[model samples]
Target: MPPSHTPVQYTTRIHDYPLHYTEAGSGEILLLIHGSLCDYRYWRWQIPALSQHYRVVAPSLRGFWPAALRSADDSFSIAQHIRDMSAFARRLGEGRPVHVLGHSRGAQIALELACGAPQEVRSLILADPGFRIAGEAPGAPLHTTVAKLLERGEVEPALAEFVDAVNGAGTWRQMVSWFKTMVTDNAYTLLSQIREINLDVDLDRARRLQCPVLLVGGAHSPARYGSRLDRLEQAVGQARRITIPAASHGMNLANPKAFNQGVLNFLAGLRADEARPPAGIP
Candidate 1:
C-alpha cells in the first residue's frame, strides 16, 4: 500500500542554511529536487507511491517556499544550490551514494551534482531538464517580462506569463488551485533566478557523468526539451530515455501513474543488474 499523503517534515542545516524537506518510507534514499517556483510540496503525487519502495526525501530549495530567504542579502544561484544539494545528499546518505531525481531547473542541478560529485550520486533521473546547452542558439528571455510584472506587483499576471511560457498558453488559468498556490508562494524566487546568468550545462559536463542516467520527457512537451534529452542520451553512455504519453513539461503531475511506473521500472532494472554476478563468474 502507498503511504499517507502528508509526509513527515524536517529541517537540517546545510552550508549554514536551513534546508527544509519531507521524508517518507524507508530503504535506499531517493532524493527529489523540485523545479522553478515550486517547493517540497510539488511532489504531492510522487511521494506516496515512490516512498512505498524507497526512502523519499524532497527538499524545498533556498529562496523557495518553506525555505524563505532570511534577508535581501541572502544569495540564490544554481552554483549555490548545487553545492548545498551535494552536501545535503552526503549528509542524508552518511557516506553512501543516493539516487537523485530532479525536474526542470532542478534537473539541471541533479545533472551537475552527478557530474561534479559522481561519488555522491548512485544514479540520476532528469525530467524535462530546463537549461540551455552550450551550442544552442540563445532563446529570447522569458524571465524579464515576468520579473517586470512581479516588480509591478502584478503577481497573477507574472505567474501566468511564466507558467504559460513553459507549459503552454492558458496553463496558468487551467492549473488547479493548489498548484497555483504553490507557485505563488515562491513567485519572488523568479526575481533572483533572473539575476543569475551563464549557468548553462555543457555537453562535456554530461559526458563526465559516471552514474546511470534516466532521461524522461513528456510526449507533448516542447520540442526543445526533447532535443536536449536526445543530445544528453548521445553524450551519456548509460543514459536511457522515456516519454510519458499525453503529457507536457509537467508530465509527472499530469500523468502520475505512467511517470511513477516508468521510474520504478528503471530503478528496479538497476537493482536487478546489481544483483547479477559478473559475466565470467556466474
Candidate 2:
C-alpha cells in the first residue's frame, strides 16, 4: 500500500476568492493540480512521496471544496484557472519557476499556464489531459447522462454513473466512503462541467513550449483519452510518453507506484539535463 499524506492546510486570497491548498515537505516547489469534481486530496497518494524531494502544493481550484464559489461570470474558465495557478506558483515559489503536474482537466489548465506563462513553470507532467482533440466530443454521452440524472434529483446515481464512466465499472462500490462524500460535495460543479466550454486548450501553443514535458496515460483508459494524449505528444516538441499498466483515466489513484516513479524519473532527467554542460563546451 502507498503511504498516505496528512497535508498542512492553508488558504490565500486570490482575485476576490480564498484559495484553499494542502502542502507537504520542503524544497523546490511542485504544484499538483486535480481534476474536476475533486480537490487537492485527489493527489493524496502523491503528496507524501513527492514532497520528500520537493515542496508539493496542491490547491483546490476556485468554486470547489473549501474554496468559496463565485459567479460563473467571474470564475470557472481555463484562462481563469491558468491565472490562478500562475499566481499561486509565483507566490509560493518566490519568483522561481516551479515544477507542475496536472491530471485530467487540471492538465489542460497546466498546459495553458506553461504556454501562456512559460516563465512560471520549469517542467510539466500531464496525465491523461482532458482536452477536445480532432474535433472529438469526448465524454459527451456521460456528461449528458449525469446532467439528466442530476436534473432528476438522483445525485447518488448520477455520481455513480459519472465515476464508473471515468474509473471503470464497479469502481464506485470500491471507493472509500469519504471519497464518495468528496464527490457528492462537488456534485454541482460536476454538473456544470457538462456545459462548460472554458477548458478548451490550444495545441498550437502547447507545441511551442521549450521546457521538458512528460505526457502520461493509463494503459486501460478509454481509447479517446489515449488518442488525445497521442495527438498531444505528437504536437509538443519536447514531450515524452509513459503509460501506467492496468490503469485507467484516474491513473494517479489506480496506480500510484507507476505514476510516482514516472514523475520522479522525469524530474531526475530534468536535473541531469541541467547538470550537462553546453554541448560544444564539452
Winning candidate number (TM-score)? 1
Q: What is the lDDT of residue 129 in candidate 2?
A: 80
> lDDT tens string, model 2, 1-282?
134435667999888778999888888889999887899878878887888888889999988886533223345666678888888988987878999998988988888888888999999989998777546664456777787787787889988998887767888888887689778877767655755543366678887998899999999987867888888888987899999998898888878889989999999899998899988996
Q: Give TM-scores for every candidate, taking all chains together and pairing residue i with residue i.
A: 0.96, 0.92
Q: Residue 45, candidate 1: how far off, in angstroms?
A: 0.5
Which model scores highest in lDDT? 1
Error of 2 at 207 (Å): 1.2
Ten contiguous residues minimizing lDDT sum, candidate 1: 65-74
Off by over 4 Å in 1: 1-5, 69-74
TM-score of candidate 2 on Cα atoms, chains taken together: 0.92
RMSD of 2: 2.4
